[model samples]
Target: MHQTETSDDQNSRQAAKPPLRIIISRGSDASSFTVRPLMAALAAGTCMLVIGGYLAAAGYMMLREDNSDTSRLTQAAQTRFYEERIAKLRARVDEVTSRSLVAEQRYEKQIAALKKRQGEINARHSRVADVLARAAESGLTIAASDPLPVAKPRPALAFDATLAESTEATGGAMVPIDASVDMLGLRGSMGGVAKKADRRTPASPEKATISSEPTGASAGLRADSVIMSRIDSALDVMNRQSETALDLIAVAAERRIARIERVTSSLGLNLNVDGDGVGGPFVPLTSVSFDARLARAEKAVAKLSSLRDGVKSLPFGSPLEGAHDYSSTYGPRLDPFLRSPAMHTGLDFRAPIGTPVHATAAGTVVSAGRKGGYGLMVEIDHGDGVSTRFGHLSRIVATVGDRVDIGEVVGLVGNTGRSTGAHLHYETRLPSGTVDPELFLNAGEKLSGIL
Candidate 1:
């Protein structure tokens, strides 16, 4: 029973264990073995070999796939880097080109402005030259000055040499536009001519001498600056001439005022008094320079005008329009009616009956009625205490308070009052006393040409 139990136990153990087998053949002689240890070893070895072969094949396929993916990623990264670099380079080139174009346009505008200014300067120089020539022709001497030294022409500004060379190296074409040379040359020539002209100009009329000094830094100055200097000099000379002319005019006006004042003073009239005849707003002398001279001249001219107006109101013309014989003279004369030596206050003109009698000056009639020894007499007040009387009229044509101008008919010549026949009597009176009518008449005759 124990043996049976042990064998059953062994069989049970054997059933639980796995089976192994091995076979060997050599040249058709076959042999078989069934050792559990050897079969187990052989089966384990075969399984190991089969697993190793499968793992090696899988590893080789994985390695090849990894290599292909890595190569694609590297190529993509390299392409992206090259593209970014090329884009940046193109942007830089465009920026440089735009800036260069802007700079070129700015330079062109500057050149145009400079050319316009040069033209204006040339025109002004021509005008100054013409004026000098005219002065020389009018007997004004001009001395020649030393010529200005010519300067070496400067090289014009050029385009960027480096940029041009780069373009050529890159096999690119470029066209350069250069105008600064011509413009600068023109400006230099104009400056030279102007300098020569300035040297020839006389310094003063009195000296009539010109300096022959060579131009220095001033010749190198801009055209506009040189023109300004010439203009300033011309203005100064014009101002001096204006001052001289004003002085002459003032002197002449003073002489004329003096003469008028003297004549009015003899008639007991003060011209300085602000009478109804002459008065206006007073302008005071406030300036101390050229303006003061102008003010004085204006005042003098105004005074002269006032004096002339006053003189016009005085009796200084023939009462009759036509020529007539004088029947009597002013001052000590024989009275025709009285037939005696008496003081004759007026002059008598003989005319046909009913002949027109006129006024010798402009005035308002004060009295126009019959008076003692004077019939149909007309008296006129010619302002500033001056008056005139006309008498012995056949008919009174003018009434009292009537304004009459010089040479206007006032009455008719007739034998009336103390007059012997058809005649007219005239008298000139001032505030002080009566004056001789012949004096004014003679003065008027002398001044007729000027008037």
Candidate 2:
């Protein structure tokens, strides 16, 4: 009974799923081939595996493409953020640049003003230097040192005492100053100071250009500050140099004028230039500027020059050449012809018969002819109400209306007229009357170097 049940179960199972079979036949050969169920199943399993693998590969590729797109979008957003940040920074930079430009402009203006002032100061100093050079050329020279003439000390005013103290601190004591000497070494010291100032001073505008550039705003500001400081120092130095040079010129001119006045006064000469040609209301100097002071100094020098010119034309030279012996002195003496005590109006210089008699000063011949007591006489009319006469001459070489200079031979000495010997009778006359010739000769001797 168990065997029949087993066989029946097997038969039923086979009927439910019969074996997969396929047959092929060749008619002529009568041969056949069949595919079994197991082979068919194996083939199906292999096909399913290939299809699943293909599907899995496709899905993975799609996921990878999506991730790539997300990455691209994220990169774009980050780039936009960076671009906005850059724009904001650029705006801030522009603002800072504008502020820096304003500051730089201010500094440039200051530099321009300083340069102008420096130029002006340099011009002033140059003018003062020119004046000093002119003064030296005109014989108004001041030595580095000279003998200071003793003088009564001037009573110092309150202001003068204070000034003296200040001056003493600089280099010298408060004593009388010498006109020809550069007292207190003020001139040399001021020149030294000026030289030092020039060395320390900044360059001119052409040499030193204003710049406000740097790696950053801070650096530019610092550079500007340094430039400003340098310019300030340059300005200070230029101003001081100009002032010192002006002062030196003024002081030197005034002192020279004072010396000239003293010499002329001592010689009893009133050669002061007359200002009657120009008339104006008297105005005292209270607020005199540098230019005014310089003008006054110039005027003083001009006065000195006028006095020198007058002195040169004075009758101060001898009428005879070289050394000469006086035959008779001027004033009351025995007359040459009468031999009686009489007033002699002129000096008699004893010389050889042909000795040359020269003109004492430059003048025009007024007369050259024989007179009652002064035969072969020559009279010269020097300007300024002065005249000279040469008497007892051998020959009158100078004609009337002839202009003669000092030391020019006007005649020869001889025993003519009322003279007892070969001699020249010389007389000097002023507007007042005939005066002694010795007065001018002595004055000339005293001022030999001055003229």
Candidate 3:
């Protein structure tokens, strides 16, 4: 027993000590559990770690929501900036397109044609422009934007229908037209641009913006491929419209001139279209082919001038100022005095006594006195072999050789000539002899509004 007392025995006694015991109590029951100090501390530390983790997660979620709002606001501002930039670019493109609109008349074409016919196009455009200028000078001002001048063209059909559709397709906000472009001046610059266009190869839309243009062109008026294509199309439409207008005007003028010629022939008169006074320096025609359209236009212009010069000289005025009612017509009629078939050489106008007679046209008084049958008469010789005679006058105021103008008072009405009562005998004497006075008066009525 004395030999069992060793150091190892004491260390094993400390290590074998039991854990603490605790008792749990409730209303009618109770329980007991044992726990070590290290285990209690470890359980408390686990609960704290879970609570701290949950709080950290909540703060992170709130921060994320705030960041999302800031992100949305930043994105919206950038979108608006881009939208404004896009609008400005569109405005600039439209403005560039308006440059060609300054030219008058109209035409249209496809983008495919842009690659071909550069030199020919330049010359053709000049001629097309002249069509408008000439038409305007002839009193048919063809507006650049106007459709075909024909009344039926407003509805559109076939070619016109295509133009109408294209017009609608190209419609956009148009710039106001105030200034005019000098087309002749633009030729050189346009040719250079055309060369540049030809030298370049086709590229994608994104890279097809104009690189450079002639300095003589409108300042800073450049465009992308889309805008350039549209401009080309508009110019073509204008040219076509001009040609259509020229055709209509030329045809109409020619027909009117033809009718005028027939009327003059019936009167036994010649109308010299190229007047007596015309002299100018002769310049040869341009290198461009003499356009048949231009030739037609020139002819039309000549005819218009003829109407102004020749027709104005014709006796297209009334002999009686306000009253031209005829009691007896020219040609064979029953004689009012003899009651026999007689050849009437003049028109007898119904009028009261002492009515003032006016000269039918501008002329010199050749005879202004009484004759055998015509008691108190007057005869005036209008130029170009045209003469007028007024008989059966009460009193004659114009003497022989008196230069008289149209509508000037020459005499008074009365029963002076081979007396049938108070009336006027008017005769229009042509080279073949006295023709119908009514014919000239009727023609005058027809042309009163026009010439």
Off-target runs (Cα >4 Å) in candidate 2 are 1-270, 275-288, 321-327
Clashes of each: 2, 0, 12
User: CA shift at 64, candidate 3, in angstroms?
Assistant: 48
Error of 2 at 168 (Å): 62
In model 2, state the lDDT of residue 432: 82
| TM per candidate | 0.45, 0.50, 0.46
lDDT of 2 by residue, 1-451 (tens): 9999999999899879855555566776554445577777788888888888888888888888898888888898888998999998999899888887888798888878888877877777777666656655445543334444343233322212222212211111012223332222222211221110000111111111111046776886888789789878877866655454445555555554455556556645566664434467765443556577567556655665676567657777778644443545455533334433355566666566777888888889999998767878999988888888888788888999998988899998766776555667888887887777666665554444445
Count backbone clashes in candidate 2: 0
Off by over 4 Å in 1: 1-226, 274-288, 322-325, 353-355, 445-451
Best by TM-score: 2
Q: Which RMSD values do the candidates have, in order?
A: 33.7, 19.5, 29.7
Candidate with better lDDT, 2 vs 3: 2
Comparison by lDDT, 1 against 2, better one = 2
